[model samples]
Target: MRAALAATGRVVRAETFRLLRKRRMYVLAALWWVVLPVLVLLLARVLQVTLTGSFVEGEAVSVKTLLQGLASPFGVARVGLVAPAYLSPSPYVIAVALLAAAGLGEPRTHRMWKSTLVAEPDRRAVLAGTFLTMQAFLGVLLAGAFVFGAAFGAIGTTFLPTAAEGAWGRLAGLYLLQWAHLATLLAFASLAIFVLRNVTLGVVTTFFLPPLVEGLYAVWRATAGFEPLNRFNALFQGLELQATLEAVPRWFLSNNLYLPARTSAAPLLDEVVGTLQAVGEEAGGGPGGAQIASLLGADLTLPHAGLVMAVYGAIFVTLLVVAFLRREVA
Candidate 1:
């Protein structure tokens, strides 16, 4: 037992070092830091111009308002994080697929499995170490995104909202839920790699299959009236959370779990829109209103989304581990 644990630790360490040494790690970092912030900045500017008709040089109120819209916990969780995390072909999903393929499938492609098996001996420990390394890498990526968002908020607003009152608890909950969602993505990608046993095939399938399946499922559900099929899709399950009806089944994977903050922010958004409309009316612009419902849709009180995502993640992990154990390295 002791030897197995020691071997697992060594494999984990080696895998971590290997991942960090990859050129793609630098590319991922650059996207998170440089590209994401610049995109946010451009989005803010566009919103400012649309809302207020002109960008005031000294006054950053428009920018701040736009930032508030984009940075709201609700918008960030649903549209920003959840959408990209679950939606197939997204940069986040593709990056995770690539990382998982490189981590687990590369050994097979490069014929390193025999030597690795020789070094570790125990296949379970080797698989466990790879899983741990992938989890660690994903955790770091999510943490880096959080830090970049904080920096972006600071740059856009004079006073970033502090964790006063119950804000800290809410923020913490949002982070945890988002982490859980991303972890599910990681497990799914790992499962694909283990099943395919080829790096390129695994990455391509993981990147493309979910969306294709989702599209087909959507058509079947609409045309065939098969609502139960919705549960099988992570993306569809997420969208169901936005349903306005009170009777929508409270699924464990709905986006509602992390978007309560968005509900609270709705009134503020309405007020901002009202203000913008008043200014526009005074300027002789045509009748216009900020469609809050269109922006955020209806808020549901389902708490089961987190639980569903957790269950799916466990299932994916279990399957991946089983496949890895049975796989012949030689």
Candidate 2:
């Protein structure tokens, strides 16, 4: 057992080295983690400013205030849209998938798997290594993106941003749920790559085609009046994370901040009330809904969302390991 763990560790280090050896990995990392996040925050801020005319609604609002409002549903300054776009599952997942396809797929295509197996010998270790490296790569990107996005969110405000409690835990759940979502799909994509030996085909089957086909099928299903919508909904599963992320943080902020409405000194501004009430209604929110918003993300509970997606991932990943062990390197 200890030996297997040690072997897995070594393989993980080796896989990490292989990924870092590719120059494009760094480029993609910067683009997705840094560039894309910053761009999204700036663009969201600009949209808010163009319409509302402030970095935050009040120039005097603290930097902490902006960070609080971020990832929350309040559109007072339109800061909350970043989380969904950051985790859009398509563009972002495709970026990571393209890397996985190009990096891992090409090695198989070139028949390098033969030499790799000869060197490592234990197929499970190699698989574990690749999986860990991908998640580690993604972890760095997720953490860096959140930090950069939060910092960027505070750019035009006055004081430093205050990060909050168990709130961080909720956001962590959001990102981890994203990790599971992407991890599941990427695992599926890797299986497809191994089976077909074509990165384009593999990724499209797992990532690209599912969403498109699902959308069309959903329309057809609606037209045909299908009863249950739960079947095969994994491909389109990030909204629960987005809604939960937005909902919980807003709860935290409302508790901590001194919005005039909270004090009954003033009613909610027309825009703020409209946006919150509209989105909250769908999330099962209403008067006093903000306090209980943490109960569910959008329409689904986290457990339901997690189970629905994780079950498929568990099956695909098990098959992936088995297939790798049986695969012919030559």
Candidate 3:
């Protein structure tokens, strides 16, 4: 058993190395890890200028003035956004799905099982080795993102606000969820790789299936109490707070998780659309910055979100292992 496990580890490691050796994979990984964040930060700064000006009237703001204002708010603002990305599961799904699918797509390159089969003839071992190695690589890639996000967050402090422990904790929790999300993607991709025997089909399945499943589950959940696949949505998705927030009357943008609400007096597009008529309420009133500050006065929430994601990882890892073990290598 020990020898088999050791050999599997070696095979998996080799698969990771094989992906790393490819120039295209290197580029995609770097773009996700390094390029995307920098661009996002730059864009965030730009958006801060544009949106704040649009929302706040007669504020006499230039881009420079807006940026200066943000320096103080940077930490808090980041707490709301960038910190989440560090911990968000969305990136991991994307990273693992694309890379692993692509890696499996070019099976001719790795010929991973060909040599191993000669020695052991255990197809399960070969499959396990490939899957385990890919999963580990996905994990490393995820950790790298967290580190980069946190580091960027620290730099953001230079312009934003100081680090808060609560924010850091949430970030950690979010990453945990992201790890689970990655595992699911890894499992799905590995299975798809084995069955489809082509990367594009696998990639498409990985990319499209989560949302499709979630969407179908949502339709079911609307009528039925709780849908089974509904739990998997966040694991695949980057946290989109705006979409989930339920606007409470002059109080909070409640996700029903009891975090403080953000205050921006702008009416949500949904509210504005006449498709859904409001029952005994005015359409245009929302909270202000003070309200947001009041709601999020403290970041005392434990990471239920991350914990949920961990469950996803655990479930899928088991499934993937079983599938890999049972599948025929040839």
Candidate 4:
């Protein structure tokens, strides 16, 4: 078992490094993590300014107040670091999903699996590594980009972020929930890759099929007695199966979680959304920047949402492994 675990770890590390070796992945990572987040931040701050300016008729607005409100860069702990991305089937997920599914589409084209099997000889370990590597790659790309963007966004808004220990715990939980979400995506992407058996088709199906089905489901739900997929309705979806957040947790946007956490204990994290709507209401972040503050929250107060992802992750991962083991190599 120890040997198997080691082999899995090695495979995961190797697969992760293998993906990193691709130059385009970096470009895409930068586009989603750096460029997109910063762009979102700037636009958010601008919008805040525009709205605040338009609403205020005549009052001596303090510089301090302006500064306090200026750190509007989204998904940066002000609005639950995952909020902006959770708001839609973000390019971050799409790009990652496409890259993962596309490359692994058939695997026969790459023909690395036979060598991989010879080296590792454990199919389960191989599959586990592949799945984990996908998530790890996503996490590294996301966290790396987030660190830069958060630091840049932190300017002027903070005197010095001193996030509480509780805040760090909540943040860690939120990230765990986020990983569950990514796992669900990878499971589906895995299914798409193997089933479609073509890179282009896998990409198209993985990215596009969900939204198409969602539209039909929406109309059906609207028209009559549709209810099985009611969960999908509440969470907005577009382009495909990519889900949009219905209600994000309000974390109270303590700036410390955004900056100081990085310089200190790396494992501790902060919230992006509320663990539960009730919890969000209770935490009372007048500023509101919650994510999963507890295991109870896990991306949403809705057990249906969390449960769906969890169930889907399990089912799909199992299916993919069984399917992969059976797959014919050309």
Worst 10 residues of 1 by lDDT: 245-254
Arranged by lDDT with the best first, the candidates are 1, 2, 4, 3
**lDDT (C-alpha, whole model) for all candidates:** 0.61, 0.54, 0.50, 0.54
Cα lDDT tens digits, model 1, 227-309, are: 45555454545766434321222332223323432433546656766776688789997335522222222333325555656
RMSD in angstroms between candidate 4 and the native structure over all alpha carbons: 10.8
Q: Please provide TM-scores, in order, for all candidate models, with all chains considered together.
A: 0.68, 0.65, 0.58, 0.65
- Pairs with steric clashes in candidate 3: 74-160, 74-161, 75-160, 75-161
Task: Give the number of the best model, judged by TM-score.
Answer: 1
Instruction: Report lDDT (Cα) of residue 173, candidate 1.
Output: 59
Q: For model 3, give the 10-residue run with minimal summed lDDT.
A: 256-265
Model 1, residue 177: distance off in Å is: 2.3
- Report how far off residue 60 is in candidate 3 (Å): 15
Candidate topping lDDT: 1
What is the C-alpha local distance difference test score of candidate 3? 0.50
Can you write out model 4's per-residue Cα lDDT over 84-141, one digit (the tens) per residue? 3443565544755665663465355577777877888887888888878777776766
Model 2 bad stretches (over 4 Å): 44-89, 158-166, 226-298
Give the runs in model 4 whose Cα sits over 4 Å from its true position: 44-80, 83-89, 156-172, 226-302
